[model samples]
Target: MKNYDVIIIGTGAANIVADAAIADHKSVAIIERGKFGGTCLNRGCIPTKILVTAANRIREIREAAHLGIHVESVHADWAAVSRRMWHKVNENDSIRTYYEQFKNVTVYAGTASFVDKKTVRITDANNHTEEITGTAIIIATGGRTHVPSVAGLQESGYITSETFFGAAYPPEPYKSLIIIGGGPIGCEFAHVFNAFGTHVTLVQHNIRLLPKEDESVSAYMLQQFEDYRIQVHLNQDTLSVRTENGEKILTCSDRTNGKK
Candidate 1:
């Protein structure tokens, strides 16, 4: 068992604080389960924003014709986008190289679970086990998308924001997309797919889109969604979903209008 002055679990915004701790000459060890730079850099912000930017460029070129400016067809290549995202991710975060360069910090790529108050065990990539005893531990594991409970949802194949980022664009252009939640992730993806020529239908349990945001912000976004002709099913509950002849049929009940 090795010992350290401080151990940090996540490496996103908390890493900034840890850097400050290191500058104070406190011996530190960081154990990350996945990539460094945490969720924001690895899965959440970076890749999504990359896709959004590409999608927006395509949209702009498409609208140029309506402004009396004739433009050639807009194209988006999935493989090229994926390669660029991967390259940027690698350049921004290389954990192995960091450990080699930093003498004070010991990096272990593993699942770290607490055995007790002062001790933690990490199961590394090669199934190796390492134990560390730290005087202080900071847990910065961020939030994950909450896939709500709906009938027959678990067995049905679906994608969350994390998986969606890595997913290759559909081989053929899809005519329409039905997104389950009208929250940030869902709405953002709706915009991306819509820009790429897919009609989008956003379903929300709340009366307004982006329920958790400030009411005024939500109202503004709802108006934008309406302007974009993104179909919304507000205050509706999904009763069931069944795949029929390779198409998913969702049965929903509208709570506000008393329609099923």
Candidate 2:
């Protein structure tokens, strides 16, 4: 069994610090279960920010017309935007390359699970196992998408932010979009799609949207979303969802009015 001085289990901003150990010529090992770059580059921040920036630009253009600046309408191309973001995110050729080229670093792609306090078992994609021991271990499996227990939603073929990347833009003008959550992801998605000519309906389970943030900020965001022509539904319970013909329809009960 080969051993090392350090073992880092994630590949994010923290990796820079971990690589520093290699720079010092200390024996180093890193493991990743998925892409070389973690959630921020591969899944979370980068691509979403691209869409947000696009949305913001669209907003600026539309407002410019009202500001006495005549400008033609522009369209969003999700595929192109997604591709551009992915290219930049994957610029680092390989984590293995980083480890190999470094003075004394090694990288393995696998799942690292604790077998004991200072020891870990790494199971690779093919289920091959390696027992690794390190003086220090770091666990940095970041955030994951949380799916709500809405009726029939699982089978409804709906898309999460992960799925949204490969999802094609609606060819027909999206007359309406019913976003189930009003958290940051939901708000950002609402803004993006709405800016891209989709009429948006934002539903939140809480009394006010963005309940996780400051109350004033939530109220301000609500007004901003409304100004962007998004319909805000607060304190609504998602009862059921069904596919009619090809479109997804959500059955919801308004907590405040008891109306569906």
In terms of lDDT, the best-performing candidate is 2
Q: How well does each candidate superpose onto the true structure, as a TM-score?
A: 0.87, 0.87
Model 1 per-residue lDDT tens digits across residues 41-135: 77788877887888888877877887898787777786687677677766546654654366678877898899999998999889898889999
Off by over 4 Å in 1: 65-68, 92-96, 125-128, 167-176, 214-216
105-180 in candidate 2: lDDT tens per residue? 7788899998888788999999999998888787777777888898889788676665654455344436677888
lDDT of residue 108 for candidate 1 = 73
What is the Cα-based TM-score of model 1? 0.87
lDDT of each: 0.79, 0.79
Question: For model 2, where is the 10-residue window of minimal lDDT?
Answer: 164-173
Error of 1 at 183 (Å): 1.9
